[model samples]
Target: MAATIDELIALVEQNRDAVVGDLFPVREAAPRLIEASVYHPVICLILQGSKETTSHAGSVRLGRGDMLVVSHDTPVTARITGVPYLALILPIDLERVRTLEQSLTSADAGQAASVLQATVAGSAILETLARLLAIRPKTPEDSVLTPLLLTELHFHLLRSPAGAMLRRLVSPSSHESRIARVAALIRRDYARVHRLADLAREAGMGQSAFHHHFKAVTGTTPLQFQKDIRLSEALRLLEQGAVSVTEAGLSVGYESPAQFSRDFSRRFGRPPRRVLQGIAAE
Candidate 1:
């Protein structure tokens, strides 16, 4: 089997923006700034170069041989700082994790901290990843192999040093899981009006506790979380030329054009009109 980093670098070199099997993405790019956006639960392993993620929780820099586990949907700014940055992104399957949580003993309940964190991955995790990367599917039967390997991959993550934190993240009754459910709700319904009270109820917590745990889990208030999702969607729509500035804003729950413009400008560091103009010029 090819070395883990070597295989990942080859994949990225072949298709820098390729999404391999909807489970992970191979990104190869030059150093650049990435705008703030809501990142879903995922594990990022940097194979080459480095990057930084900045959120309300703080800034964290990760490089080769390091792993980052993001437990919830969080809005943050990221920057790639390598000549040709290559990273592997594995989206966490919460349902699968929840199922696995049943097998974990009380000893697995480790301290929990939300946000992107740097941790060392064990050899078992690396070996499993290497085996996963080496797979070459040439038949229908081979297709099933990938899912099995993915399940194995998740298993390794559940037993790694960060496993306890991950366990807390997926446990149905944990505060982190409650907050994550609320975040998922915001992501799914960002274009609709959401009240803090309603969201707190959904999380099975009182308003004050919900607010505290929401911020603790996501590093942002419930309202800001919704706003981030909306603005992120609006930016995406504008970038794709799918809608006019006003349409984009209004489509993402913005009723007042003026308020949308101001918020868009503040978040993206540029107004929608100007961003559109630049895109057109390109």
Candidate 2:
């Protein structure tokens, strides 16, 4: 296991600034002070050193041998706690999860949060991940084999102790899944004004029930969730220098420049210009 980890680390270091296949680069020199946008569901395994994640739901610190499961798109503040942090990021395969859901009995279903932290990972899971890292997909057959390996990895996770939370994510009838659908809608059209009633209708729930269940699953109300997504996109625009601050605000559905600035400052701990300035300096 130690040797496999070492091999994985070496592969990550060699591609420190680039993603190798589906693996996100794992290089950070300092603890990031600003929240980075996490726009999808993924499983992150800490292979070396440690890191921390803070969202509205709560905060979690993950060290070597720990894994984190994020079940939706959410804004999270993350920073490395140990120098030279190394981690493996795997995107969740919704199709594979849905397939696994069909085989789950009623007894396998349970309510679980969108975010989970686990100290243990199955050895088989780790070995399979290592194999994925080692394989170079240069041919069509290799590419075909990659998804199969990823499916196998998902199967291992579904049977692990952490499977319950994952099961809830894929169960079409589960409240968590319903909330996920709404969250996806919010992400897809965050720039548009969303009516609570309409969103509730789409989720097949009453307004009050949708409000309660959305908050329970996501740790924030629908409006707050939309605002977060909007601000995150606006921040990205500002960083990219693609638009002026006013334009960025307007593009993301904020009509009032003053209101946008206030919300942006409150969320990011600085005004938009200053944040952009800092990024430029970096």
Most accurate candidate by lDDT: 2
Number of the predicted model whose TM-score against the real structure is largest: 2
User: Least lDDT summed over 10 consecutive residues: which range in candidate 2?
Assistant: 107-116
TM-score of each: 0.89, 0.90
Quantify all predictions' global Cα lDDT against the true fold: 0.76, 0.77
What TM-score does model 2 achieve against the real structure?
Answer: 0.90
lDDT of 2 by residue, 149-172 (tens): 788888877766666667787767
Candidate 1 residue 235 Cα shift, in angstroms, is: 1.4
Q: What is the lDDT of candidate 1?
A: 0.76
Q: In model 1, which range of ten residues has the least summed lDDT?
A: 17-26
* Candidate 1, 178-233: lDDT as tens digits: 88888888898889998889999999999999999888877788898888888888
| Candidate 2 displacement at residue 244 in angstroms | 1.4
